[model samples]
Target chain A: MMVDQFVAQIRRLGHGVIDAVMRLGFAARFFMALILASGTGLRRFSLVVREIYFAGFMSLIIISVSGLFVGMVLGLQGYNTLQRFGSESALGVLVALSLLRELGPVVAALLFASRAGTAMTAEIGLMKSTEQLVAMDMMAVNPLARVIAPKFWAGVLSMPLLAAIFSAVGIFGGYLIGVRFIGVDAGTFWSQMQAQVSVRTDILYGVYKSFVFGVVVTAIALFEGFDAPATAEGVSRATTRTVVISSLAILVLDFVLTAFMLGGN
Target chain B: MERSTYDLWVGLFVVAGLVALLALAFKAGNLGASSIGSSYVVKANFDDVGGLKVRAPVKASGVVVGRVTSIRFDPVRYQAQVTMKIGDAYRFPRDTTASILTSGLLGDQYVGLDAGGDSVMLKNGDTIHLTQSAIVIEKLIGQFLFNKASGGGKSPSSSTAKAGGL
Candidate 1:
């Protein structure tokens, strides 16, 4: 009896650990399939194109508006510091560089997570809980391709455009702060950035980071939904976990991607 | 719910808009590449160049006019020959000076130019008569450390006594 009890305790712990991991794997797979399915089954150029338009381009206004304020804050801080060295004119570099490489993608991803990400998780969770998944099955619908496809495709396709809008708005925001609030010359602000501001890598990294972020977020949201518990209680935990996990994952992944791209070569 | 054709046009516009935006960005980025500059050869007699690479920005009035196109040892002069590219707009007179400048607190280094009054402007392939070689921060820091070891820990601010007024 003692030996049996000991074995049971170890087995229970192992099962608990495996269950947590399975939940995570399910989420990752769900996101990946969304991307894969776009290219594979639901592969209408027009449809994917439409999905991209709605997902990526439509989200531009929200991202840019948020990004502009971020730029303003960076400019305010950068100006104070750069003023000490008499490099105030180069506030463009400070604002532009920070906005393009770091602030734009991370901030937009967080906002997108809040706006669409939570809703996606909940929708998926509700569907799974009510077994609407079974009704789709009986109707000969591919659940992965139909409903999940739109969200997944939207997240992946929308990122780069959102990032670009974010960067443009952010720089403009910085310009406002630099010119009106502080007395940096508008010409000097622009020329300084023009002189030392740009590189292909900066733009490339922004676009690339956005694409990766889109994949990660959709996957997390879908995973939580499909993996929802049979009971109302289980579904609640899944939704909460989706938000917490995805937001944190985006931040961590952003840093890792930044380091690899900038620091590697 | 049935969606109409008008909803589809909005989708088309979004894709077109993003493509246009990306193209514009790539075009602007090309304007700032290091390769955009004029070429001028400058023979600097450095015992060591301290790893100055080719295509590095050469500046005048903090504006990049050219780059270091080549760096080779002139065995004949026993000095490092650094060929620089100054932009066409910048006419370096016969006695113009060249030195490697650190752009900021960071080690982002570039070459600087100071024009001197000379009747003749330098043509391509003419080596700059006056040249101040690269200043490595590591060497400067090492010198400071050596000074500290010998003189017993004076604050570094004392060394900047000669560098008066911003």
Candidate 2:
């Protein structure tokens, strides 16, 4: 009986892995369909514009405020460390590099996932539970093209822009702390940063990372919402899942992208 | 919001994002501003590059005049060959010495040009013959410890003196 139970547990674990793989496959197909349907959806440019405002504009305040705080903290920490070595002038380089290279994209993506991504998931999941999706299907309208495609594109386009704003605000915050407060030479702060950070290497790659993150986060949120069981509890669970899954995915993908983009450099 | 109002706001948002990106590229990344002015290329050979990287500033008298464009290994001499692009407005003497220098006790490395009293100015494709490699801290510390051990507990300054003599 013990031997049989052991076999049963092993079989259950195997089935669990297979189930996850199938779900992943389904998600991939769903994402591809959304992408293909987006061209048709693009004709309704108004819908996309509205979605962009909802996702991008709505998140600007949080992105800017968080960016400023993060940058100020970096400046404070960088100043304290560099002061010990009499290299306080390098504060600009420290702050700019930290923001452009790592913190900017990762932090902004996390914020986007939590704020915009969870909202998208909940909205779509509620629509599913309320049978609005069924109504659309019965009316012979493609829900993928009408509903998901615009949101998918909007999220994808907003990410890089949000990341840029974050980095820019963060730099300004650093300048305030490092130069205005700590008395590091203003010229040195700007010049050192200009000399060190590369447009292609640091900034563009960061934008690219955010772009990928945007697509991943939006896709996950939409997929979870679409797959959610048509119940109130299911919609709530899906919203929570969107946040948790997108956050984990962002961190994991950040590591992979960093290894590929920055390891050699 | 009305369609036109929404469009205007979205347009403003995109413009702001682009402006921020441009600021980052120009102010921080030093993008197209480099190529906007005329510049010339000069090469220098170093025994070691240490932490020197492409785009590291090439400074003269603590003022940036150019940037390191590329670095490659010279297999024949087993030295690192660094190519720099100096802006045309700030010409240096032909006999200028280029050295890899750290900005502080622990900081990024940059190419520092010490202009010599030569009458002729360096032009494009000119090679900087006098070049010093980066000072590796680990090698210096190892040398110091070796001297101290061999000197049988001598003062640190004395050990430095003996090491300098070696």
Encode model 1's per-residue lDDT on B91-148: one tens digit a residue: 8787888776565444345667899999998887776767776666677788888888
Model 1 agreement with the true structure over A239-259: per-residue lDDT tens digits: 787778889999999989988
Query: RMSDs, each prediction?
Result: 5.8, 3.9
> TM-score of each candidate?
0.73, 0.89
Give the interface RMSD of each candidate. Answer: 4.3, 1.3
lDDT string for model 2 (B32-133, tens) is 545537899999999999999888888888787888999999999999999999998998898999999877656688999999999999989999999999
- TM-score of only chain B in every candidate structure: 0.65, 0.83
Please provide, for model 2 over A212-265, each residue's C-alpha lDDT reduced to its tens digit, 9 standing for 90 to 100.
Answer: 999999999999999999898998899999999999999999999999997767
lDDT of 2: 0.89
* Deviation of model 2 at A102, angstroms: 1.7
User: Could you tell me the fnat of model 1?
Assistant: 0.10
